[model samples]
Target: MEKTDNIQKKIIEDVIYNAEKILEAFNNELDGVLDYSVKSLEVIDDDLLSQFHENLHDVDETMKENAIIQFGSYIFEVARRNYGGKYYWYEQLDQPILVTGQPDFEISILAFEKVKQRIENGYEDNIPFFFKGYVQKLATAKKGDKELIC
Candidate 1:
């Protein structure tokens, strides 16, 4: 009985330790992603969007298609970097961070803009709710860590 109990306790402790490490890594990754997104937004000049559209209009048919493909690829890279990529290490943690984005550049931009416009039009309530859920999960995981320590 004593040996069984000891083994169980050890297993629980190991799980807790692993969970803590995963959570820390997740938080660090999220911070980095958020910073990158902010920087990307900052670098977008006022006329860049218009310029992109204008260039698309002026290019030959083949070049236009190529430009569209390249632009889509670029958007995917940015989205992947900013919104969690192929390996979601964070998902291994107690509270996983769910990343949401479209792979299609046209749809991605349209959706992003729609969301932005909605928020600007006073639909900001959902944003807080969404973040609250994420924050609560993190807090819960932190509490779990403390419980494990005790």
Candidate 2:
């Protein structure tokens, strides 16, 4: 009985270790893709930006799929580790408008209520242009039927 218990504990530890390694690999891959996307956007002309804007709805729809949820979970874990208990934590419910800064230096999700309040009260002029866009996207997004915001 004692040997069996020890074996079970070892198995659990191994499973957790393997899972952490997998998550690390996923984060590295995601970081590469995001870096490439940002660089590509930076080099694009105004016409291309306009084209991207025209296709924004389609892109938004794609983002709301399972990938976004998984990505949100990843982001939440990262935030929890880095920020600790400084900010309120929530799972990725619907499509969260991600507010990321230069790779992984600083990243966070904007709460739905906060986004709504910004829309009602108006954003301060000092807020960055990209963040304002994120707020707007969150405002217009349709909430997921099953996922809770908080």
Best by lDDT: 2
**Model 1, poorest ten-residue lDDT window?**
102-111
Colliding residue pairs in candidate 1: none
Global lDDT of each model?
0.32, 0.34
| Top TM-score hit | 1
Off by over 4 Å in 1: 1-38, 41-49, 85-150
| Residue-level error in angstroms, candidate 2, position 92 | 13
> What's each prediction's clash count?
0, 0
lDDT of prediction 2 = 0.34
Q: Looking at candidate 1, what is the lDDT of residue 38?
A: 24
Can you write out model 2's per-residue Cα lDDT over 1-150, one digit (the tens) per residue? 777567545533433343254245443644433221223222221222233334545655443332223333333333334333123223453333323332323334543333233222333311133334443444454433111222
